[model samples]
Target chain A: MQAQDLTTEVAGLSVHLLRGGEGDPAVVLHHSTGPIGWVPFHDELAQRFAVHAVDLPGYGRSDRPSWARHPRDLAILLNRALEQLEMDGVTLIGAGFGGFVAAEMAAMTDARLRSLVLVGAAGIQPAEGEILDQMVLKEEFYVQKSFRDEESFRAFYGEDETGELADLWDFSREMTARVTWRPYMFDRRLPHILATVRTPTLLVWGEEDRVIPRSCAELYARALPNAQLEIVPEAGHVAEYEQPETVARLIAEHVGSLA
Target chain B: MFISYFTERPYQDEQGEYINTLDLAKSNADYNPVLGGDLYHRYLDEKVYAEEMGFDGLVLNEHHSMPACMGGVINVEASILARITKRARIVLAGNVLPIWDDPLWLAETLAMIDVISRGRLVCGWVRGTGRESVTHNTPSPYNWERYQEAHDLIMKAWTEPGPFRWEGEHFDYRYVNPWPRPLQQPPPIWIPGSLSKATVKWAAERQFPYLMLATEHEPTKRSFEYYDACAREAGHETGSQHRGYLFKVHVDETEELAEQTARKFLQGPSNPFLEGNQGQVRGFMQNLPGMNSRTEVLPTIETWAPAVARGAQRQHKKILEKKKMAKGKDRDYSGSYEEQIAKYTIIAGTPDQVVEKIRNVLEYLRPGIIAIWDGDGAMSHEDTMRALRLLGEEVIPRVREIGKELDLHSPFEVSPVTNKPVAEAVGVG
Candidate 1:
């Protein structure tokens, strides 16, 4: 299935998303590195479910809502977008920075959210380790760190000789800097607020996830009332990006069980 | 001409083994307070001595989380200078506006400095480098907007009879009143810039003296001309008094001694921001997203607009020049000593040679105000004092003579704010 590029207005913002697949709806919110088109994972997930890969405001081709300054603001906007798109009974999956936004949405309203899957999400502060500051490291090095193994990283990003990928990464990082600069990626009150969210949650973590600490997934599991933590070995921060087939199998099982 | 003494007041120490300049601010492990305290006192002493040596202004600037400049909070140093220095304008060139969440404090503190200095304050504002946004945790995207708002807020807080509420987009206050207002009625405002055309235009529109930091001579001239054009468009007459030039210059009794001492400017921790340090360009930190819109990388020299350049022609030229820069040629200053001398970015010689070099700059740029940047990097206290002595006793007198011959009058001689002679403005010939 070929992913079709589409745009939907959410609270006056032109949100860019890629739509492909069949069956139940699974909305994919991109990581802080920004959306890099529909990848192999999106295709795999598309086989079982209708995957909607979204570029959050200030990211990709989406019209940036200049007024929005926090993940919570993005969450409210996304919830409104889902409502506008008439997407109910949705399985919301978010990775990295997007995961933070997804968790916020789930906490705010479970109206359209049927199930939640957070992969190495950054919202709740980790007890043991800190979220790696993206600004401190070079864009190329930072993206490379996202995967556990060399082959996994090269497979997804390829050898970027032209610095085009680096430019995209920088553009995305700017958006990340805009919203998440002050308190960084985590919300102080998110842990408490997330406890009240009754949405069935599945927390996925790359065993070697270096960006957002692996302990963050454990924290998210603790925060959510109905959530289970699954640690995938030989994977990094974006486990879905690295081990797509395994992550897709896990998501399929989680969503299938929910149905 | 209004001449000032300037320095980064750098902490002289060996750089860490693991860190580059981009990482130096956060990752540098080689910082000692004992050395820092001594250096701070030493810098203050140099400023005091610069005033004693007859510098018209004692210029100080601010930077954060970096060893390049220990003047983390310039107002703090300015307050101390206010008490110590009897004369010489406390030229803040200047405070980083965007990082200050509460500019009310800035207003109050500056007001106090003016009060203490008995009105010898030339206030300046800068949109700080991207490192500031990162270290201070300010939103980089809103840096320019915040800088503008903060500038407007501060101006209003100073000029307008207060207790008036300020409801700005970035900042707001219920009570916009501060005690002990600045003695200089709104104080003489100056804007210093290197490359950003927006800043140069903004300064020109306000009729503020646009102090050009160490830029290539040709670009500096072009920038001044651009400022002139901008000022003209704003319906103001501009002269040399409306522009200023700052460059690294050292004078000693002997040429060899001068060059040796001046070479110390490149001795400190590698600073990406400093021209001579030539640190690796960490594009992400330097070119923060919204902070710089033109390109998402290091601005190449020649392609990058100088302290001066103007209009649609300049823009077209820049576009062509930028294409050249994109090819990864002449990316930045090499920070080599020979290159520094060749580009005239650094001038180090005997009193005669230094004066001659100063004349060349004066003739080229025709700036009313000139800031002799010295005492930076690892130059010792003695070296700085000797250089100041030569500057005050020899170079300054010659420059003053040239200033008259070349018709260069500083803001004091000719008010930049009014475009009228200061004597006329004050009703005294």
Candidate 2:
């Protein structure tokens, strides 16, 4: 199913969005590298739910929120965007930096969210290892490290030698740097704040994820009042991108349980 | 012309074997601070002698987490110069502004230096490289904004009656006052640049002298022309006083000796700043996410500008090309060294020959201040002293005469800040 492009105005700022499929509403907040339009994960989710993929403020075609200096700030803006769209009781699926935003939003207020799914999220600091610093690593290398292996990454991005997508990647990284500098990907207060969140949260992690470590999953599980950790084997950071079918099934199961 | 002596104060001990793969800025497994202490003293001694030799100014700069420039905490050395040197202007060309968490401390320190030196301080500022952001952990994206804000904060602290509050985009302070304001009101503020047109335009608009840091002759000229146009647009009459050039020139009794000693520019610590130095900087580390994106110009490290990005790509490309050429062997890229010499990146000759070359540069750029960047890489103390002596006795006098002939007056002669003569300068101060 092809996604239809939509532009939603949230408090004078234009937010780029993609809508597809049918049934209950599910908002897909993309990673820091920005939105990947209608991927296998989105397509699979779209089979049962109306998938609404959004490019957070300062990413993709969305207007930059100049005052934004942290993921919590973006979380506030995303909350407003969801409120403006009138998206209530929706499954909020966030990946990478977007997951941090998702957690922050949930912590702030979960009135808009029915259930929350965070894949390879970066909010709570991992106790064992680091959330790979994308700032220092080369852009290509950073992209490569996000997948399970070479074949999986290549199957998705395929050499990318033309550098045609470099500007988009750079813009997204700029947004990431603006928001996630100093404390890096994780928020120090997020774990404590998340204890107040009552939303049914499903924390997804790739067993072989090299970006945000698996320990972060345990930390997230411990932080949320109502949360479950699901580890997908034979996948990396963005397991939804690598093993889309499995991730979709897990999400479906979780949502079904919530119903 | 205001002739100043400068150096990167290279550590002079990094082994040649690790030049290709290891980025010395990030790793310090081979660093020895014991020897570093000795080298520091040696560089300080050279600066003192530079003053004794009659150089109008002594230029100093700061770089972090790198052996290429040993002046990581240059204000300490500047303070030392303020005490030891009695004649020369202690030009900090300058402190890396954006990385400083509290610019007030810098304002206070510089004020103390100026008062101590009796108004012989030419306070300059640098935006610094991406490596600075990584090493200092200063946000790279806000590097330029922080630089501007820090500058504004420092300037206000220096000139205005403070105890005022400052709330900026990057910095927020409730109490914004520093004691001991500078003797020269605000000192002679200079903005040195190379490739970034945005910086040149900014400096020109403010009528601050923009010193081109060891850039090629034609590009430097074009930059000055751009500055002139910008100055005109900003309703200011522009000349040499608004322009300066940092050129690498070594003078000796014989041409061969001068060239040989100056050729050591690439022989010391492997520096990414110097061409054909067999040094390698990681592309990602140098071009950290927000380092260049803030600026309007191209983001490479060529032309060695303090501003964001452009020339770095060329340097990285050279390293990669060297990798390709030395695929099976341990050969070096000798072509870049020859190219540097041909391009006058490193000009070295007999006193007369060097003077003639300076005349050519004077005729070409007509910069009021020509800072001689020497005493760097692995050159011996004796060689550096001799070069300084030749520069002070033979080169500077001739250049001063040429300066008058060409009507090239420095910001000291005609202040770029106030457009008034600095009543007392150099030795008088």
Question: Which candidate's DockQ is highest?
Answer: 2
In candidate 1, what are the lDDT values of residues B118-176, reduced to their tens digit? 99988999888766777887888888888899989888888889889989888989998
The true-versus-predicted C-alpha distance at residue B291 of model 1, in Å, is 2.3
Model 1 chain B — which ten-residue stretch has the worst lDDT?
A: B305-314
Candidates 1 onward: DockQ, in order: 0.57, 0.77
Residue B344 error for model 1, in Å? 1.1
lDDT per residue, candidate 2, B1-429, as tens digits? 898999989877745433443453446777787878988999999999898888899999888877778888889999999999998999988888989998889899999999999999998888777667778888877877888899888889888997999998777889877878889777878987665567777788888898888767776787788888989899888878898899888888897798788888877776666655636666566666666543344222223322212224533344345445432123323325576777777788998888888888889889899899988777889989899888878888888999999989898787675665657444333
What digit string (tens of lDDT, one per residue) describes model 1 on residues A1-259?
Answer: 6789889897777999999999889999999999999898898899888999999988999988888889998888888889888998999999999999999999998889889999999997789988888876777788888889777889778788866787688788888888888788998999999889988999999999989987787788788999998889889998998888899889899988986
Error of 1 at A57 (Å): 1.4
Which parts of model 1 have CA positions greater than 4 angstroms off?
B13-22, B25-30, B279-281, B296-300, B303-322, B325-333, B427-429
Scored by TM-score, the top model is 2
Q: Score candidate 2 by DockQ.
A: 0.77
Chain A TM-score across all models, in listed order: 0.97, 0.98
- Among residues 3 or more apart in sequence or in different chains, the pairs in candidate 1 whose N, CA or C atoms overlap within 3 Å are B222-B308, B222-B309, B223-B308, B223-B309
| lDDT values for all models | 0.82, 0.81
Error of 2 at B147 (Å): 1.3
